[model samples]
Target: MALMKKLTVLAGAASAVSYVRKNPEKVNEAVGKAARFVDEKTNGRYHSQIEGAVRKVSETTRPRTAE
Candidate 1:
């Protein structure tokens, strides 16, 4: 049962990664909106952290180009 649960979680994560890779523009837009929302909610207390997280996520999800 534990193995099954782990497999399920891994599969879901893989699917999410695939979707992000395929729709990087949309993912980045949503990430930006989410970061803005969080920043506003926190009154800019964590603006830098939010921006950094957004940058990291965007970089990770960006589609790779062929050489």
Candidate 2:
């Protein structure tokens, strides 16, 4: 059970890395969606932080396509 848990964590981490690397546009879209969700939940109180976070996520998740 413990080993399975460790494997699950590893798999999730690896998928996260690959998702960010391969689908930067998806990452950007997801970030935007998340920001919007938060803004709606907070009634726009955290717009600055949400936008900043989305921008940071987009900046960090640049695509790495090989030709």
Candidate 3:
């Protein structure tokens, strides 16, 4: 059972990575929505941390341009 769960998680991670690579804009949009939800739920208590995490994710997932 544990092995099955791990495999499932790995598969999901792979799928997410592929999706991010293919459509970084959509990924950023989803992250923004999640950040807003957290901010509202916490009444802005963790605003800075959430914003920082979102910025990092956005930077890491952005599509790379060719020279």
Candidate 4:
């Protein structure tokens, strides 16, 4: 049962990563909006941390270029 659950989670994660690679712009836009919303809710108290997270997520989802 535990193995099946882990496999399901991994499959979902793989699908998400594939989607992000194909639609990096959409992912980045959504992330940006979410970050903005969080910043507003926190009154900008965690602005730096939010920005850092946004950057990391963007980088991770960005498509790789062939050498």
Please state the error at residue 62 of candidate 1 in Å: 3.1
- Kindly report which residue pairs in candidate 3 clash with one another: none
For 1-67, candidate 2 gives per-residue lDDT tens digits of 9999999999999999887888888888888888898899999998888888888887788754799
- In model 2, the runs with Cα more than 4 Å from the true position are 63-67
Candidates sorted by TM-score, best first = 4, 1, 3, 2
Candidate 2 TM-score over all chains jointly: 0.75
TM-score per prediction, in order, is 0.87, 0.75, 0.83, 0.87
Q: Candidate 4 overall Cα lDDT vs. reference?
A: 0.94
**Candidate 4 per-residue lDDT over residues 1-67, each given as its tens digit:** 9999999999999999889888899999999999999999999999999999999998898767999
Candidate 3 overall Cα lDDT vs. reference?
Answer: 0.95
lDDT of model 4, residue 38? 100
Query: How many pairs of residues collide in model 1?
Result: 0
